[model samples]
Target: MPIDHFHKFLTSAQQEEITLEAAHARLTHFAGRPWLFFPEFSAYVTSFVNAMRNPVAVAPVDASLPLSQYFIKSSHNTYLTGNQFSSKSSIDAYILPLLAGCRSVEIDVLDYKNEPYVYHGYTFTSRIPFKLVLQVIRKYAFVTSDFPLTLSLETHCKAPQQIKMAQYMRDVLGELLVTESLDAEVMDLPSPEQLSRRILIKNKAAAAHDPNSTRPLPDAERHHSAQSSSDGTNSSMPEAKGGPSSSILSKKVKFVSDLAQLNVYHQGSRLPKLPRSSDSPDLGPFQPHFDQIFSLPENKLASYQNDFDRLVRITSTNIIRTFPKYTRVFSGNYNPLSFWAVGSQMVALNYQSFDFHTQMNQALFHPGNRAGYLLKPD
Candidate 1:
């Protein structure tokens, strides 16, 4: 390489004048060029070569801290490869992110015949079989990092298919799926080291009235009626009515025991309303359960920020995930730093898009052993 080109790659401090003798000596020492042995230039070249080195040292990640205290690298719409509205959903989408050290991924599942399929529901995106997605996840989940992987499941499947979804996850993932807490008696959640090499399902738990049964609750019947009117038909598997980005709105959907049991640690729930007054005496009602996780939309983050103390209180004990807004059809990503600044653990980004925000996401997780989890600053 030419001296000028080599100088361009060095830091400013290393870009000082280089004598021909020093240059030849440095090249000979590092590259070992055969021509450097020529007698004509032997006298000018010296054995010693001064080289530049990185000044900053990377510290080892402390994985023993509570899981809620770290900012986890996460991906949104993990099955979409391109535009959100019309992209082809493939298992490779899951593989790419998992291998890139993404610890959390979203899986939107709906019923297809007797089986469950993964896709962006109510969109033109093609679908992949639920079982196949699980298999792919099992194969590549721990390739880059052994930290726990959280599967944020958005299930719109009926009873029978919901059972199959659970069965497939149990069968394919095997012991990797966390069926129960490692230390149930502990007050705080388990650490990443304790849950290493395991997968946690983040989904809504079944209603308490019939936790072990698939019977539809009263709310489910109301949702069925509303869904029938919206679709103008009595479809057994009613389509969820709303914008594509809206969450699984049907609280009435009955969850089978098999599927609900998989939500051992991270139970998905709606974000509760923040207290209007900062000096409000009671935060007990606003606080989320220890095992609960709130999936707040990007736009809603500002509202939470207004009550910064409450947000911190909620996040200190439980996990908070913030995803992209609904209108980002081009797969653009929002600045994740704002979410991270407010102590949100999982600031999920569209991994398929290499936008500025996504690049920042990559840079942030590149340190701390790239273990997909970094302890937040105090």
Candidate 2:
């Protein structure tokens, strides 16, 4: 092969390292060989290769800032092995993404035989024992990254099962589960560095006044109802539509005090409309506090595109999470960049899909040692 052909494959920096004189010397040294195999030429080529001209330094992440300041690599409906409607749910679904550096995972819990089970509600998806899922998460949560793992829990179980769910987490996850705030007086959320290796519960907290009451909490019920209206599938209970599943779906349930109290940093709540201006003195009635997380569907988030500046202001101090639109029944993912561009902290995607959107997600989180958290660019 001509020397020029080999030189063309080299990057500019590589070419400078292997000068013309050096290449000629290398060729002359091999000229007398009886057999000039491709492997020898391949080895010569490989020696001059540089994976990147300017490689990023592999350093520990600066996780001292508030959790809202980082873009968390997240997954939606993480237990499904295939499409959203009827796919088989498996523990491997949780294993794959956690091993791949996903920092947040969604777990939809429903009551089965008076016990908590993990699966998609109002669908034909298979169920996995909730305890088994917790065990699997315990084993794999920090395998790829030790920053923090957020469990986006959607509970549809009564108080008894909700208590069991909390007990299972405590017994199986042990010290990995975060049961209280790192600081009692600090107003801001804890940093990823502070919560390293800890698991966060992102479920709606029951009313402080009555923890174990079966009565629906306004904030929790409103959030799930809005989500149901937007996504077509209720996170807690679906309205009676007259079907075999109607009796089950119509049963309203709330997370018990045991499970609700476990939510420390990421309290899931409905996001109120942003203030019209960044300098507006009055935040809306539903403005999320430091420890609260605003969960929005992709479609709803897109509606705020015209108010980009306000969105940025909101995300700067509060955690905003966006997931794929409910219409994506096949487990298709939305482009996460749209949400990330506006500083949304957790843009959850369907990990089962390997399409362009997911590819972009993998590439974005590939840096910072794949620690599953990246500081938002100012």
Candidate 3:
């Protein structure tokens, strides 16, 4: 059936309101927890939930909802864009709407001659200076919001200049900056916020550059590659397909410790830190914040179970891979089938607003156009 017809049936059946309530209840259970909204792709899930048979109620998007703030790139045209659509104007428009409720925003920091610059890689030249971007961010930061607009910057390379660029942002944005971990599961993922805080240095290899050296950060076993340069930096050289290091494991442990320290130092109180188990490596990274929030004394056992179950469901590999653009767009006899399955799905949904649809199309169709952000079109 056409999705539009399905939506109409949902509205006509009064099932729409019921499903929204169900979704809201699920969201409330997850309140105060960190959640990511890939603005471009989340609309699909929104539409799915809206069309589902469940009597869940989904709330309209509100900035102040209990969600721990997350960040995304400037690929979407936010309210700040002011209507005219050019690449630069597109980015200029999002600052305010994002600042409205976001606790943190991602900035991709590039190092140019030992200084940090804030433009995404796709817009300007590869070697654009960091100061130039900073000037623009300052000029366009016209957002008015109560909460401080925190920054979560990512460094594109292991280059020493990444560190220096981060320091510059701290100097400017001050305590609102949060240096995101580069070992963010995938390596060298684009982060714009790194321009505003210290870029997270993972292995000894990344540390060798000294863009802005800190207390010797611990080596996390999660090396991009084992091969090291004479300067102790991890080489971009690919590894020969073995597992990560024991020291790297310890480094991850230490990294968690640093995160705790940062929360305490910046956020005032330290969040709960769960003890690492001797049990299983299959359990992956443990988020102490989730543990703390769910463990609150008054929370219902049912609520905890519901949230945990949904969390597991959302984090599954299948759910993430469901994004059409994330999968390779194969070209063959089967290409027609793939296009219908993926491309048509993207075109079928009805968003709450036309602005949202426009922004999403930019992300779905032109992901490679953003600097600092990389989408594998392959």
**Mind sharing the TM-score for model 1?**
0.76
Compute each candidate's TM-score over C-alphas: 0.76, 0.75, 0.33
| Candidate 3, residue 41: lDDT | 20
C-alpha local distance difference test of each model = 0.73, 0.74, 0.28
Off by over 4 Å in 3: 1-104, 119-129, 135-142, 175-378
Model 2 Cα displacement at 270 (Å)? 0.6
Kindly list the per-residue Cα lDDT of model 3 for residues 261-353, writing each as its tens digit: 222111111112223444432323332221011111111222333233333322221101111120111200111123222111111111112
Deviation of model 3 at 57, angstroms: 20
Where is model 2 more than 4 Å wrong at Cα? Answer: 1-56, 207-251, 275-286
In angstroms, give how far residue 233 of model 1 lies from its true place.
Answer: 22
Q: Number of clashing pairs, model 1?
A: 1
lDDT of 2 by residue, 1-378 (tens): 555544444426354567655555555443322222343354333221223444367677789999988999999989998998899999878876775678999898888998999988878999999999999899878855779999988787877898899999999999999987788889788899999999998876443344463434445345534544465543344223233444665565565667877877776665545557555534454444577677888888898886887788778888888888767888899988889999999999998888899988877876535588998897
Report residue 87 deviation for candidate 1 (angstroms): 0.4
Candidate rank order under TM-score: 1, 2, 3
